[model samples]
Target chain A: MAKKILIKKASGEKEIFSIIKLKKSMMSSGVASGVAKRVISQIRPKIKPGTTTAQIHRLAFDLLKSEDKSYAARYNLKKAIMRLGPDGFPFEKYFAALLEEQGYETKTNVIVRGKCISHEVDVIAEKYEKNIHAIIEAKFHSHGGGKTGSKDALYTYARFLDIKEAWNIKKNKGAKPREATLQSWLVTNTKVTGEVKIYCGCVGIKAIGWDYASEGDNLQELIENRGLYPITVLISLNHQQVRDLLHHNIVLCKQLINQDTLLSRLGFHGRQIQQLYQEINKLFGS
Target chain B: MAKKILIKKASGEKEIFSIIKLKKSMMSSGVASGVAKRVISQIRPKIKPGTTTAQIHRLAFDLLKSEDKSYAARYNLKKAIMRLGPDGFPFEKYFAALLEEQGYETKTNVIVRGKCISHEVDVIAEKYEKNIHAIIEAKFHSHGGGKTGSKDALYTYARFLDIKEAWNIKKNKGAKPREATLQSWLVTNTKVTGEVKIYCGCVGIKAIGWDYASEGDNLQELIENRGLYPITVLISLNHQQVRDLLHHNIVLCKQLINQDTLLSRLGFHGRQIQQLYQEINKLFGS
Candidate 1:
């Protein structure tokens, strides 16, 4: 029998190491499949019997950084987005901006009356050309260990049903009837359970989570393809500094690179501002 | 072997029914040991092979109501307090009032600085006569099925440690220090896990919940002895009505009983107000 190598998780649980899982994660960061396999093989030999997952991640990240710095940053997407919150407002705003980049007009914190009650939607995306409207429930986990589960999916689906019923009622009442197709999409900054994925599939609701994707457009793809990295992704700033930036709605690193005065407005002074600029350039520079 | 009878739980899981558990629940409602045993014996035969715990609760509630209406209300105390919240603000206010009734000067939503951070305490009680100060973290679950777990207890203790450290620092700095003992209490409207109870006992942090008590003064004893029933206890009002009342800080039934205009201010119509008055009189009348 092959030796069972264990990888320690952040939560102190241990699981058997899987090279396949590692390769898939690398490929999701936009690395070519061939390079992903090569990188995995290179790191596999270095993995000891009881290697921590964090150490393995560091090894893979170093290789990816050497190969392509941007891809390395993209690989760290989950952790970066997590730093945007103790509250999920920043994540919602960033998600809206990502949708906006894809030619969708987006509104955050939109409240609409459902049949029995009012629903506060995290992000509402409208594609006028396609006449497509999506009420998005953005479930953000502030820490990496937390997974969005079936309970959240059930809650989101129920809300969608209510709003859909309300919409039909309004149409029948001849209150601003329009030819837009409405659908519900659950978006999260972390992975979701297999149960949630299956539930969404059965119900015709869309789910976009860290690793769970539909139509090849998961959160990782949406973020990396647009190069819209949150400001927390930068290694230069501390946790409090990142939180301060998020509080000011200065979400993306590209926003910081483009707007010089933004840092001063957020009360970043002297050496801190200079340090942040250097880190941004190093991470985002080709 | 005695026949195994299953009792369905709130979360839809079923377990073998234990008469001991049922008897304990009855005794916690202030029923005498002999009467509790009699009630248990009476209901034992009525319980079918696979009856739900909720059905058993209803049976006991009916029996208690017939025996003594106030005891019935006290039996429903946990559920009533849960109805006081979709948010915990109302419970905090009610808790503060309960402390006041015990001759303690109380404040809610008090923010005090810690060693490294600031903590927003749910309730702070100070008995000036005894020179005792207690910081309370009141965890209010909006549903009966929810539990206060070790995680919350741990978090509360950590916060208390931080504040205690800050307090020591202040005392050392000659910040007008008085010699008053500081202690932490974790109070909840739901039952806590055994792990939490054990942890609290070991650490000298007081844990008080619906059924979980320290030194015999559990949530049930406190509320019943003081006659501080939250307005949510009234069966006459719907969930939304209870929520609205809580939102306006009309927590206690006595508040509504005392002020006739309060119900009108809360937008309760003539018939609904009359119904509320009748229910209040039935529950709290001398």
Candidate 2:
């Protein structure tokens, strides 16, 4: 099979540029040298057959750790609600686990659902009282920065997220009411287009172009200053546990209510029982 | 299996509220009754057993939609990210899909990771612009709302996020360039302690107790807004396609540099290619 181009332009005018120069412009020129140094270790002369992408990511994470440079993959949300097991593409989770080894307390899998609907919020982090945090959207494609065959693929994802976020807010009654806020982001080693700007606008999400050339915060700093928190309820907030809490509370309430109902069914016959019932009523209220 | 209980004794005696009162205070009063009133098709005493959680969520979404109420399950960030396919949670992706029939988008399995480090950001929407436009962090834990647990959990998340925003400003060279400029937020279903006044220190972020009971925009609306461009990017001045326009210029530079590199490698030795060499050099220089 022939190697596929990561980016392919159709009839529309297409242009290609040097990865180094592109990085220099987007990121400060000084940062490019550091990024290049880091990339040197990640890039292999040849790939070993049958290596899973997860393994490659793990290698990258490990390399960054050894160098003491921060890695983006290390910090993630808590894994309390809707926890993804090893089978899932928990690249950030795995990265976070490595950060934990460094004695950093990172939260994993924060469950941020749409308030109107139960949509997942991926991951979240916080400083002290302030909420200057970052949300990450991971993409796991077969090819690394390969050309996306579908037109407006990234845009579709962005729009979908925008709509989903809206639905979540209007639903979950017990959820904390937030404002119309979200700094939409896309984290993919995929090629995008100029049209993405308009498409993203149509919804309200941003398509962050994260390819080999792109450089973000390293894992150490991410883990050191910011804790990792995944967006899954199972992971971050422990939805199952919360559900259990709710269930436990409900069961206790039912028991109390049932006792009251039973006493009423019994027709308040005994004086002592009636006194006890009255006390229970006062405790539980009408 | 039996559930575990987490309780901590205070240094001194503290007032304990009745559990029933707590439940009533938190329960959805008018909404549930309204939903029950509209669904007169078949009044079953009990919901069916062995039904998947997703199915239950779908039913809830349907009921909410009928009442003009939103469904929280639909806005899950995880579900939206899953639309990208491999990067999302398998169970959530499918479960959210089931909710779609009821006009509710099942957003699930959103993969969010922090860019650097922070405590309070729920989701970092867009990362293209120099400054972070919005950061959202959620607080949902089973025991977090308890007497001791409630006070510290959210406060810690909030404080961490605020610090992160400040740190990001320093790292990213935000205006004023203090170790504090990145804004963030703290969103929780529960309220924070008044005594923990440290949350007041959150410079650019807001500590919000999502008080579902009160009326305001929820987390979903905030996320959707972040998806929108210009606003999401925090461009010093708004530009429709800030990234593309900037990237186009970068691409032009790359083309010029690539032309130069090619010219250097050609060696000017080939007779046939030599005639074009002078023209190429002049073109690259300019």
Candidate 3:
């Protein structure tokens, strides 16, 4: 059986969990068995560059269902899946979901618009008790370039908004004054340039960039540093420490996805869970 | 015609470049554009949970060639192409080539065996007036379900190495006492966990961490940041300023990639480039 612990955030929401709980859930929910099958049946050793966003989605969804494990969506998907196009990248949404499962009460895909222009953002993410934390754009690019897109892209777009001018109207209308939005992003598998830098600075927007190759590290930093949120936890944490925990979890997930022990104990119909088992098995190459 | 520049490095190697210069060489050298074309042509959208490292390599090579650009190895294939496996992830090797094209001296398929074990790292990188570096490993996994692999994975593998113990031995004496070896990485479509914070502490080996993502506003901060260069760069310039320059360059690269006029001007003839163009077009599709 898994152990459970309740965590209270500064905002007063409490979440209960434990590795054991995750392990138990993996076993009882048939997530392990299904994942194993998904690994075996769905994962392929060769994929192409122009693959569609939806294809990637189906792969993930199929793998999840195969394992009899839910996507932990109630936490991240509530916002991620709703805000993003089928092909657009879903890091923040998914990470937020992971946090949610860990008991963080947050809202993803909250829309925030320029006060006057009404330019809509894809996601306005907020942690509970925090004020409008970040304006996020999840870009799913086919290539991973490890840089932002266009030096002049933001400035050109800002020319259309004049968000500062819009903010003035809101202030005059007796609304709370707004600071310029923090860092924005051009998360793609392409690179960015210097001109984009000049434009973003002029408009008070910062770009947190990512490419396909660097997505893993970039996403982790965005959440931990909150590219927009930069609050270090009162307790100290480092990237490696967090990476270890994640690796541990991923390994365990992989194991559960591969193991037969969990499936036998869970009393799941062996045939029904075969698909999930294949997916999990494919992931670890078993 | 593309502008020409000298490949300058902290180490005094001299090389001049021009579009015509490379064009003349490609034509006269009788390089098989077909190999590059075939490599890049194979790049297409990856099916989720089914993609493999080898597939990602095929896509990147294809993408590189289609830009009318050659893999860094095109002009120097004997030393470059001979070393790689047909179906292995070639990220480290590819980037090393790019760095070489930009004027940095490089090595390929170099090995560093573990002091007390039978493990070996794939590439060892070095440049003038700087510490040696290592391109450890490249991981490809299905996107989603939160985290994928990262630099921490490399660092975890580091503790298992007997660098000091191995170096002290007569056989491994050439390894040398150095500031640090670069912990360079190439991750394709993976996500890392935010909990991975391991700077300035003794986790496994002291100060052994991977610099997988960019951190700090300037290059100086980035290098000092420990999170960005676990593996590359050979510079004595101001870190922040270098970072700023990189920031600017990245933005510019993004712009260049997105500009239809520019892409057209570049005269790349590969199908992979076309795929990139199509993907971008789809992002802004009406």
Candidate 4:
């Protein structure tokens, strides 16, 4: 009998390596199914008994990079997002900005009174024209193996009900009943479970996760469609550089590429600034 | 001019020592004005420039102990309460027990929904016959200098309004309007500002503090009247021992005096257990 080949997970647990799982992930990045199968087959023979999932990811990433750089960038989205935080504030800032681009006035780290208590809302977005207001809970996973599960959806739903009750009371007190509409969304940098998706849908709570959107508009699709790639996704930038960019609220790659002054303001010298610009163009422009 | 005597505060700041303030505090502890004045005069010559307020407190405490040990115990009430925590959980437990003694069914750390939001109430007490429900917020100050201020009063008022709104909504939905009456109380282990008392009184929110009381029933008065003293008041036991006792829910000194099995359960051996028993009797019996 052949010895079982295992891959070490981010959590230090080991699992049997699956070529199908690797192929599905690559396919999600818009890589052709044939290309994904070819990449996984080529990488499979190179996997050692003690090889880590990170090592396997690197192997697949390199193969995709050599074949097609844009696909490799898209494939690296989850890993790049995982690097965004030791804290969730940066992701909340990025999510707020994404909402802003969609014609909503956005606020992050807001304390709003609920019907029974006060809550520190992560991101709040409002569109006056559409009479739409959304309270968003942004969950950022700092590790590849982490997930936003069903419990998070349930908790978000409870919080939403509280906020919705406050809105209803306020409306009845002075404003028209239909003057404004309130909604709650749970946005995560990692994928959510199928159970979470089902629960959220049943409760009318919108959930946006990496590759786990209800209407084919996941976090990656939303960002890529708007050219609002986070600065953390830049190939040339290190984690520290990305963190510094996030600290200055320069979250989007487009925000950095459009402003030379902003780059200088971040204390980046001429050579480093030039490299960042070139990398941004190559990754985003193509 | 004579050099002014300074006293160190719990916040590590120094202020001019005031005899009038000392007298007022002692009077609040049930010390007669004449006795308080005599105690101050005896300690006056002993107080030196740069002497810490803690030292002055010790001098007065010794004088009170010699004159009347019960008054000394009452005077030490604030310090004993401060020893209840590095966190406020123990104080909440004690407060819940205190409410139970007052003929109210009590629940601690309860999540109750209001008309506008959900509130995690620290202590909820209900007198079934009277249909009176009181939501109590227990503010434990680990340091003597800490205070429950006007801002706390304002926040508590807002929470009260939310809970009251929920009650009204529930009453309108199905229950009779007079089925239940709701009230909110702020209970703290330190002094509250006059502003807080005034604001609370104006809004019908009950404010209870170590010395500040809305209806002449401060925390000390309530505990002393009911003979419900927290085990943290025992000078014989160290902070860790008090914390361990509180961990097992052995809050009152009276409870410790009655339970031999409970003491052994807390890992207290012969000598230490005897000392605790003796100290409890000396403090409570006098």
lDDT of 4 by residue, A1-286 (tens): 4467987987689998887788988997778898998898899889888899999889989998888766677778777777777788888998898889989999999998776556679999889888878899898888787778755765676567767888898888887647778988989998898767776776677889987776558998888777677777666677677777777888877788667787778778899888777777766655
Q: Which candidate is the best by TM-score?
A: 4
Residue A28: error of model 2 in Å? Answer: 12
lDDT of 4 by residue, B138-239 (tens): 888888777787556655665666677878877888876477778889999988877677667766878889866897688888988877887766666777
Candidate 3 structure, TM-score to reference = 0.24
C-alpha lDDT of all candidate models, in order? 0.78, 0.34, 0.36, 0.79
Candidate 2: where are CA atoms >4 Å away? A1-88, A94-117, A125-135, A148-180, A201-204, A212-286, B1-286
Query: Chain B of model 3: TM-score?
Result: 0.35
Going through the candidates in order, state the TM-score of chain A alone for each one.
0.81, 0.32, 0.37, 0.84
What's the candidate order when arranged by decreasing lDDT?
4, 1, 3, 2
Better of 1 and 4 by lDDT: 4
- The deviation in Å at residue A222 for candidate 3 is 5.5
In model 3, the runs with Cα more than 4 Å from the true position are A1-86, A89-92, A95-116, A127-132, A144-148, A151-164, A177-186, A189-204, A211-217, A220-286, B1-286
Q: Which should have the higher lDDT, number 2 or number 3?
A: 3
lDDT tens digits, residues B19-107, model 3? 33434444432335664444333443332233433334345434544543333223222222222223333434444444454456766
Better model by TM-score: candidate 2 vs candidate 4: 4
Best by lDDT: 4
RMSD of each: 25.6, 27.7, 24.4, 7.2
